[model samples]
Target: MAPRKKKNASQIGSVSDNLPHNMGPVPEIIKSEIPAKALKEEPIDSPLPDSPVAKELVTPAKVTPETKKKAHKYKLNYEQSPFPDHPLPTPEVAEEVHRLLSKEHGQRKAPTKVPPPSATKSGCGEVPDLLDALLRTVLSANTSGVNSAAALQGLIQTFGAVNGSPNWHAVSQVKPEDITKAIHKGGLSVVKGKTIKNILSIIHAQNVERRDALLREKVTGEPAGVLATSHLTQIQKDAEIARIKENPLTMAWIFEIKKDSEIIDELLKLPGIGVKTASCCLLFNMQRPSFAVDTHVHRHCKWLGWVPLNATADQTFNHCDLRLPSHLKYGLHSLFIKHGKTCYKCRANTNPGSADWKKAKDCPIEHLVDRELTRKPRKRRRIEDSDESEGDSKVTSVKRKSSGSTVVKPTKKAAKITQSKPVKATPSRPLRASAVKARAQSSQVKDDSESEVEEVVSEYDE
Candidate 1:
């Protein structure tokens, strides 16, 4: 079927240039008002008189399709794909109309601010339990799982019972000055000391019943903020995560199916969170699959030409989400940050360098990843070759000595006996070859010991 063209931004139709010198012979009223000196011819070298009609040269353009198209001043949308061979879907007018109407209706009635994170039953999937979520969040920050697990185990061993959830007093009992005893190995205790206290405080503020209320309440109003209290340890959402979670332009905002402005207001109400934090949180927590581009992510995305160089972090994230895949968004966010940190050129904030920018699959993202799912580790290719080569090399290196011992057929036990036979009582000065054999034996022993440690199981009170 011939593709129907909707109105593009091309100029409607070319109007003739139709330039004329005189419409009414320089109007009689202007002639009457002219002074005699003004009517006199002016000298070219003299200061020119202030004439009302000071004309500048403008060549009349020709009227061909090319000229007409140029005159109309049409250019493709910057975000639009420009390859003429690859076409995109034309938007349905009815759907477009419905979208516009829904937007208009929302604007007319929506609140100026996001109501509190009213209690809701669903979101972020069957989300991790609160405590588990916090552990994951904290563990995820600037560290690895093995270390984070070590820290959590340490905390549990000291403070909590066998089940590991701390009682209110369990948290309160840990002296602020000595909180390091609980999280020292964590290496994140510099700030985590306060985080522990904060969690305890929330525990205090939210009695089991009140906690339920907070989680379930659908009330749309001002947020209570990260509920802080003297009785509580005072852990609120950090300023960073809260800010990113609140962006009006964020997918969460869209998911909330509310006005962009509404979600932004609710996010700002968070104690520590700001715009950037809210934006990030909205994508990460809400699973809206946004780019959630942070500072590191912002620099790298643009350098790869996936986005404009001048874009803000949020813009970079939005542009990427639009262009990249769904499963890949979060991975892209984390990987970009990792890549930015690892590859200096990608993160060059002040002094720039040329990046060997690769595009997305079509070299579009211009890097190993733009969205998270784009990154897939390469498969090991040389394993079979390595095994074959190693076997061949060993066989080749084993030459029959000139002493040319006869190949004697023997039963397995007899062959083993011959191989294990002791050398004759030759008087030995310390042999360098023996020392090498001894060193290899000792190294093998150490490798076995280390492997045992890796496979070690705890003999603990169950």
Candidate 2:
């Protein structure tokens, strides 16, 4: 077996044909191993690991000059809003509306002479204290202005300090029954009392936060030169902080917030404070520009077309604040309230046809009133006759003849004319049968024609 037999040429060719063709040289996977210490010695991309760092490294991956230049020149281009919810009034229209209202309301004249310091308008008109106005506004809800004022007076009288002013700290500490009894003059006493207490608690919490923040700075060994009570001793500072917590309405921070919108937002965080109440505080107490929308404001704005017909009272408030300038908010709100009370048509539950509305024919904004006075269509009432005699008399009376002749008798009038007097039976000429048949046929045709005409007319009316 020293020499092996040579393979056939055909077998070698078949094996070669089955082998893979067009194969490229495979690359070798060679991984270099380095020391662990070398990896630890490498520097990180960022210097401060805990600080807020940009995701992009200082040395960005290589980029083209054109890309880098374009990136530097990038800017945001914002498009104007396409859909606006509130209607924007022309300056002329606004001026006209204001003029008409001012003319009727006496132009909001200032005091002609200095009155005694004792005389003062309360609530939203002349109340300057933020917390005082807030409490008064809360009392005003769902009640008349007079009742609200009386309720506020009752509360202050019950809980007022020896100095004859409301002691809010004492009020906060009083029992719920005391709060309720004091504010019973205002409707919804139980609910309003809880809201008052809650508001006080929130304010107290804020005051505590402010106190802690100040004390924290002191503990940090921070310099006190910038602190509000830096000049006062530590004991005095504590007293001042205590006073701030007690009389939260007089807190410096409440009036320091510049934006009326921001102030309104803060007030909304308190219990019993709504948009109307907050806005009232902003406009009157804070003397800041804010639009307070109430039932009157809502109705008037809708009539003036500043707000849409479907807009709710809250929506009307936001819409007016956007469309009307800030300066006009206070005056317009006051005037609208006055006008709504005096205007016959503007009063609650009054419409154009009401007797009181007739007196409002000369309304100041008559020209600007775009809202239509729509009255419901009256239904057509059916009139029913209650007389029984009239209904019973409709039956027709029939008479039978003794003669061997069967004939339908005519009405009383016709019978009276044909046989007015009784006639002796002289075998007089019998009534012509043809005439009787003709008369019956003609009457039936007349009755059918009348009925057909009536049906046609009724159908046409429908």
Candidate 3:
């Protein structure tokens, strides 16, 4: 036996083969007409008719909640969501962004170095560790480091011993108060006095026996005693220079201090020997390994835009510890000082003249924003000449005169040229001058002959 085939929906004549088409289709029927609601008057639009309908024959409007509920639910899907054009963020991408702003979880940054290219340690003469501190202190007094240096230089010149480290120290040791009365021409006496004393004391100790042990160890001498003995030689040299320059006999007294284990520590213990001073001594005096940070160098570093501004000296130290290579530190520190002193200046908001000038100026955005806002753009304008004449060239519409009264329309301003123009100047001239003369003569002769004939005729009649 052959297998039965399935019937297609369109091929069916009746739903169950029980109803006839005239009565109404077995599965569907339409019993009424519907009017469109396009009419403005609501009363003319008819309500739709009711009808038994097959699922396929029903309009969407005819579907009821009950019929919809009975219909099977179906789902549709494509390769992506409905809005295939735009993409949504994924979890992993979002997670990466959160990590970057988390600064604390990140690595520590190396210290930034700014050079003080113009800062002059050369001809300007460095203060001894102690005198440098004192001068710098005085320089830092009520004014900035720069001002103090100016005052210190003024004091040095006013006094006679302005040659070098030894002479400068000699001058610093005397109380500026002692001489302010003598001249009253110099700087703040009592203040300069304390500062100078502090500097001298620092220099005195640096050359003596504190951390001098470490300094002397730089040589390839034996471990313990060899270090002390080498420092002994340096002490002798410093004392000799001091005595030869200022205190002629102070060397003998300084040798007594050479008995200690560490010259650098002893030097640091002096009145003005803070870290900067100590660092200065290790760096400048003994030429040892140490980093010295002063205001100019600190500020110049910030101007380089390498480090954030407002970094403290200690913070700068920490930064340098990380970033600066060990060997370059000595030259770098001095160069930074030089550059800052020579090139940097604190400028006002209105005057940032050059690169160096702007280094210590206020925030850059300040003037720029203010200038852009305060400035006005220039406008263009047109001027009219009030006295100028205007011509409106329209022809007149009123009736005009005939040829005789045509105002003889004097040919513009040139019409009174009678002396040069011929008379009877009509445009058509078919007759020649000779033809006009001949015609007049022939007419006279004919008139005479006619008169003669009339006379003869009259005589015969008589």
Measured against the true structure, the TM-scores of the candidates, in listed sequence, are 0.32, 0.58, 0.32
Residue 453, candidate 2: C-alpha displacement in angstroms: 25
The C-alpha lDDT values of all candidates are 0.39, 0.59, 0.39
TM-score of 2: 0.58
TM-score of 3: 0.32
Residue-wise C-alpha lDDT for candidate 3, range 202-298, written one tens digit per residue = 5555445433543455464544342233445655644444453554222233224442214334544455344455455445433344546666555
List residue ranges in candidate 3 displaced over 4 A: 1-150, 153-159, 162-176, 179-189, 198-267, 300-311, 334-462
Q: Residue 238 in model 3: shift from native, Å? A: 13
Report backbone clashes per prediction: 38, 0, 25
- Model 2 steric clash total: 0
Q: Is candidate 2 or candidate 3 better by lDDT?
A: 2
- Candidate 3: Cα lDDT at 21: 56
Instruction: Give the runs in model 1 whose Cα sits over 4 Å from its true position.
Output: 1-127, 130-135, 139-150, 161-175, 199-286, 294-296, 306-328, 334-462
In model 1, which range of ten residues has the least summed lDDT?
453-462
lDDT of 2 by residue, 252-359 (tens): 566656656566667777877877887777676666676788888877777777766666666666666666766667677888888878866555445554345575
Return the candidate ranking by lDDT, descending. Answer: 2, 1, 3
